[model samples]
Target: MEIKDKVIEIIAEQAVLEPSDVTMDSTLDELGIDSLGLVESIFAIEEAFDISVPFNANAPQESDFDISSVASIVAGIEKLVAEQKA
Candidate 1:
């Protein structure tokens, strides 16, 4: 599956929703994902892609990775994945 697809799937799982319910423009808050869910989602993404995310779970606002939207999260993960292969 594509990175975006996989990301949406993972996020959907955390939100207890279907992948189709997730949109690139949707923020985690809109999907009812709280701080704990966000942390879990980040961990799941890191594991799924085998990449270390430079995210500060306790301080998301200070993190390098962007979690503003599903699209942004996917983009950040894609960049990390590419860096790992380089």
Candidate 2:
């Protein structure tokens, strides 16, 4: 699957919603995901992409990885995956 599609799928699963319900503009908070759910989603994404996310759940606002929106998260993951391949 493509990165954007996979990301939406994983995030939708975390939010207990259908993939079609998730959008690139949707934020985790907007999806009703709590901190724990956010962490779980990160883990799932990491495992799926085989790339570590530079996120600090305890200090989310200070983290290097962007989690402001699904599109930003997808971009970050795409960057990480590209770097890993390099």
What are the TM-scores, per candidate, against the unseen true structure? 0.96, 0.95
Question: What digit string (tens of lDDT, one per residue) describes model 1 on residues 1-86?
Answer: 99999999999999999999999999999999999999999899989999999888778889989999999999999999999968
lDDT of each: 0.94, 0.92
Candidate 1 lDDT trough over 10 residues, lowest sum: 53-62
- Candidate 2 local accuracy as lDDT? 0.92
lDDT of 2 by residue, 1-86 (tens): 99999999999999999999998999988999999999999999999999988888788888888898999999999999999868
Considering summed lDDT, which 10 consecutive residues are worst modelled in model 2? Answer: 52-61
Q: What is the lDDT of residue 9 in candidate 2?
A: 94
Q: Which candidate is the best by lDDT?
A: 1
- Enumerate residue pairs that collide in model 2: none
